[model samples]
Target: MKPFSVAYTSACHFGVIAAVHLPDDPAPVPDGVLGQLPEVERDHARTLGGYRQVSFVGGRLALHRAIRGLGRRAGPVLPGEGGQPQLPEGVAASISHKRTLAVALAARDTHGSVGVDLEDLGPARMGIADRVLVASERALVDQLPAQRQWTAVLLRFSLKEAIYKALYPYVNRYVGFEEAEVTPLRDCQADVALHLKEGEGPFLVEARYQWMDGHVMSTVRIRSGTPAPE
Candidate 1:
């Protein structure tokens, strides 16, 4: 059997998302999997242990699958500045993993920088509502049904994380949770407004999220040369 099974693969507005479900056993990342990675990545994986290694391997596998779906041969996705995946030229991608699942979102560079994040929908995250939501966002959540408030908060939080990942390669700076506001729209879409300082003014970014196996998968694509409305 394959070391991991494909949980899902779907086309998105930005590109494609591939999710891989890893085996429960974290050690010994299955035969031949390491060979699939570039020498650099294999060497790097050697430095990791336990679940970290599993996550790294699973992420790379998912990424390769995603790039292939985009009609490109996958290359070494080395870690660039800040450990972001340095995808092959003309490709934009992001990776996120939680426990046994790794998810990747990839697109042609023409789609601009892209990011994906996977967050577990668990009660433990319920208490983070105040920490992640801005005042206006909190007000929005307050209007939700009591049972849905935490889900709303988590959705916004996940989208903001994706927004950060999508924008960081350009801004190359820390973007706090409060720096971006996410207004969730219907049909699994959301709008992002960046509150960067004067010079960091504009970025044309779009955000979306979907529920998968009790986790929220969020993605954002920032189109180059397009500016966000004032």
Candidate 2:
């Protein structure tokens, strides 16, 4: 079967996810991306690099693949709380992978930052939304058409994750899901507005989302200097 492929491009940002149904047993490293990992990362390379598993290896590859399109030599991929990847010195990045897909997002900002996440818009067996989505978000998403509700919830989470990743470096504090609110979809993007009642006050963040081949991918860009293309 021909594997599924999804591509997204914005300004200097590019992301791609190739389908992988193979077992996550450390498949042989691909010809191009193996840059001999440090002893720490090598121990779990097989498990991490293989599909279906989420580990440092998967994170590194997602980070690398996302940045590859920009012709960058981003040093090593750094890790943060919750296993999120730290962008290179000046780049803003966020990554997410599920089952057989991996997605990365990056942006160089003058003021604000950017984040991107992709998720499988399938069943809710994980009950992940309970921990992440606020009451309001669930209320709205649950009302979406049966065929679209799954995508709506998936995009909401994906967009929020991207926003959190983009804001982490500057704010240096955890942003709750409730503080972030996603407006109805406009064009291919969604307007993200936030009201941080606990740590900070209200602010605005803009995000975009798209559904492709049963997967929902979203990107949030919050820049201070100037905005980039969607």
Window of ten residues with lowest summed lDDT in model 1: 194-203
Candidate 1 stretches with Cα past 4 Å from truth are: 225-230
Q: Model 2: runs farther than 4 Å from truth?
A: 1-55, 125-132, 201-204, 224-230
- In model 1, what lDDT does residue 70 have? 94
Each prediction's number of clashing residue pairs: 0, 4
What is every candidate's alpha-carbon RMSD to the true fold? 2.1, 5.0
Score candidate 1 by TM-score against the native: 0.92
User: What lDDT does the true structure give each of the candidates?
Assistant: 0.84, 0.60
Residues 27-92, model 2: lDDT tens digits:
555533344444444444545434433334455555555565456657666466755565666666
Q: Quote each prediction's TM-score.
A: 0.92, 0.71
Clashing pairs in 2: 111-224, 112-223, 112-224, 189-208
